[model samples]
Target: MLIAHRKKRNLWPSEVYRVKFIDEAIITVQSGDGGRGCVSFRREKFIPRGGPDGGDGGKGGDVILEASSQKRTLYFFRYRKDFKAKNGAGGQGKRKAGKHGDDLVLEIPPGTVIGDADTGQVIKDLTKPGEKYIIAKGGRGGRGNARFKTSTNRAPRFAQPGESGEILKLKLELKLLADVGIIGLPNAGKSTLISAISSAHPKTGSYPFTTLVPNLGVVKTDWGEPFVVADIPGLIEGAHKGAGLGIRFLRHIERTRILIHLIDSSSIDPADPLMSYKTINKELEMYNKELAKKSQIVVLNKIDMPDAKKAVDIFQAFAKGIKIILISALTGEGIDNLKSKIVQSLDKLDKLDE
Candidate 1:
């Protein structure tokens, strides 16, 4: 039921396309069946009553899923629900082996996790680019009559049948991979901050829940390394219980190593500036305890507003020990400082891992 809008520019004019962002899909995949073996005997003029000369059957095709960086969403799987590979060819009578069936390779986006549709068990996690996993294996080829040419059964007429292919009902789930994830409530200047630092141009509006889907952007700093960032949807109270869009998009940020907790300075109440901050943290903890324990950088956005300074003072007083960075995403204030801090944090994390 989630709708996403994409703008397409053709040769004539710019047109808007309504595309749905599908993160989960259920599909049925089937591999090819092996070919049958042949049954024949050689009858030549020079040689009388020759042995069996039938050829073996060809192998069936396999169903393979490959991960690629080009794909962003699972939109293609929405229309295509069933996939079937080509069947193998039958054996010949001239002792020639049959050709093997071609493999059906499906290209999917990185960070895709495949699982069993019925059991809900994870099959494989395709996180890196060019990662390949075999979802369904092909059947083995059948033996020919020539293979049965023993001492007693020299002219055996019977041939073995081909094996049946595997069929599976699979589920595909996509999670966006990024180094940092920006999370906050609606209208918290998350879209603005990402636009100011990265090349991603997400749609920004004054209303809440403007970002229907997650947006990814590559942020390059002066340190000569670029990292990816994901802008997740806003979360509200009781989001873990499916109250708002949080339950739908919260999984997208689970893979991120760090998080930027953006809070709107203008919307914060002077009496309780820390209430909004605590609410978002509580939602994260309710959903996943490990996620709430990740490293976070608190940022107070929209500092250029009239009531922003008063709210910032109240929040600073409440969060005395915690480090809070104040920035105006609209006017590019303290943006460079934020970027530098992010790079420094990432470097420190890498060193710690080593």
Candidate 2:
């Protein structure tokens, strides 16, 4: 029950090859072929009786996938859809065995899920860094002609051919790992708020959807441990149904323990103060119930605006019992208080889990 992203190129007609590839990459991995066996005869001047002196072929290389913390997205695999390992060397004469091929290690971001492209089967889930999984095993080497030398048949002339390598079509999906996820409609100042609270320096513009990719930042508090936060792409009405950025990037926040529901006070409707808030929650529920169930810190942003006070008052009047924080990301108002609240909420969740 997975949906493809709205924005994608028609790389392949099959669903296995359909990925916008920003967060997902569909590619092929090929292992090396085994080397051919060698055939030779030992003719020593000093020794009269010299038997066959052939050697066995080398084994092919394997295709390995490694999890790394350095990569944040699947961007590197956009143009590169195919990966290949080294081929083993051929066997040498005088009973010398051939050299083995090197393994190909592809590094992917942590929390990446590997799946088979053709069957859509789960291969492995790499959650921690430095994890590795070998998908394709190398072919076995062929035996030399010396092995055929027996009492009845002596000095065999032929050798075995190399075995072919394996080829597989695989798909990769990256899910961001963060303590908190910032969710709201477009132009709700999510990027700005994250920048103000954390070390992340994302581009801030007045236009909507300016922040295309998700931004991760680490918030260090004086009293508690540092927590990671992500500024997800904006969500509008019908987002779950592929409207706007849609559910394409929503999967990135699946691991987040809490959500920061931000809203722009100036954009609040006087007739319906909770329209935007309700819309975002509805989209979350439609996309995933767990997302809606996550604890949220409702924040009203852009309080420095002239009409923000009246709009905030209207929203608070309608939203009874819901504690809301007011902040102006541009002026850095109530940002510290908001950060403190986030730490407190995270600590409470940890205690409950324990």
Candidate 3:
């Protein structure tokens, strides 16, 4: 069963207002109504019997949703619950057509999934930058009296009314789009590793639960290509069942192509070095089997610590067939090699897709 963990809060003062990341939002959207058609007759000094000369009404505006890389969250939608497009202009006399209503283009973060609020059906999954989807379609323009003029009725006086626009109640869910996802237990150096590889500055502390939200960073390699990485909050044994902060952040890493499973080398037990490793994987499997099936790279972090060598050796012995990387995020050791490996894995995945 799914549960909502977010809470509503009032907007703080400018000085104290931090950039709060929101992943979900419920909103109402309405397209503009079509303008009414005109009914008029041509009247001139020389003309004896004037004919119908009314023009057609303009079309209503559509409500469009566009994906953007600049936005990271759905924070803007917290206060703004409704969105409306402009109404079209009415037709004028002398066979003149009315102007079309302007379209409303709302920019949202990439990897946002728009769904119908009532039916819970997914409307669109916007994962690419600059991708656009029309959530609400505008009404069609009305016909003028000139179109009704026929042989029997030479000068028609009536005009067709414009159609009504579409209205929709939508649910926007944002899943962070990252090439790599860093997952591990609490205080396992996930935040430290992201800070070392990319420009993101996630808060790090000695205690657990330091990271409340997922942090994204863009890692630029020497090969000139940059890939995005996300540092997800730690998971516990019963994380799939809403234990700890796991459920709140697990969805953020769903879009990642690769997973970097980081382990604390210093805290690993020699008797059961793979205990934490197995527990984390079990949680992933319980939450989503596909998430557990994704390609993963096991990494032992905090190798700079004095007693880490013994634990690392024990873990290596148990994980004999699995490939592992040893790194010290605080000392910046093995980060370059880690970046190279990530790039190579990404390249292989891209080739397979092609």
Question: Which prediction has the highest TM-score against the true structure?
Answer: 3
TM per candidate: 0.53, 0.53, 0.55
lDDT of each: 0.83, 0.83, 0.85
On residues 1-354, what C-alpha lDDT tens digit does candidate 2 reach at each position? 012332432333544422222266899999988888889788799977688878878888999998875555565787799998887777778988788889899988878899998899989999877899888877766677777699977888888877978999999987535789999998999999989987677777787776666777767677555667888789999999988773677887888889999999999999999999999999999999998999999999999999899999999999999999999988999998898999899889877865
lDDT of 3 by residue, 1-354 (tens): 112323311233423312223257999999987877889999999997799989988998999999976565665787899999987777778988878889999988888999998999999999887999988988877888988999999989898787788989999987536789999999999999999998688889897877767787767788545677889888988999888886677877887889999999998988888999999999999999999999999999999999888888999999889999999999999999999999899888877866
Assess candidate 1 and give its lDDT: 0.83
* lDDT of candidate model 2 versus the reference: 0.83
Candidate 2 TM-score, true structure as reference: 0.53
Report the poorest 10 consecutive residues by lDDT, candidate 1: 12-21
Model 1: number of backbone collisions: 0
Best-performing candidate as measured by lDDT:
3
What candidate 2 gets wrong by more than 4 Å, as runs, is 1-176
Error of 2 at 121 (Å): 28
Q: What is the Å distance of residue 318 in model 2 from its true position?
A: 0.2
Error of 1 at 51 (Å): 61
Per residue, candidate 1 scores C-alpha lDDT tens digits across 1-354 of: 133322211332311211112257899999988888889888789998888988888888999999975555565687899998877777888786677777899888888889999999999989887899988888877788999998987899988787888999999997535778999998998988889998678989997877767777768678745667888778999999987675677787897879999999888887777888999999999999989999999999999999788889988998889999999999999999999989888888876865
Model 3 residue 210 distance off true place after TM-score fit, in angstroms? 0.4
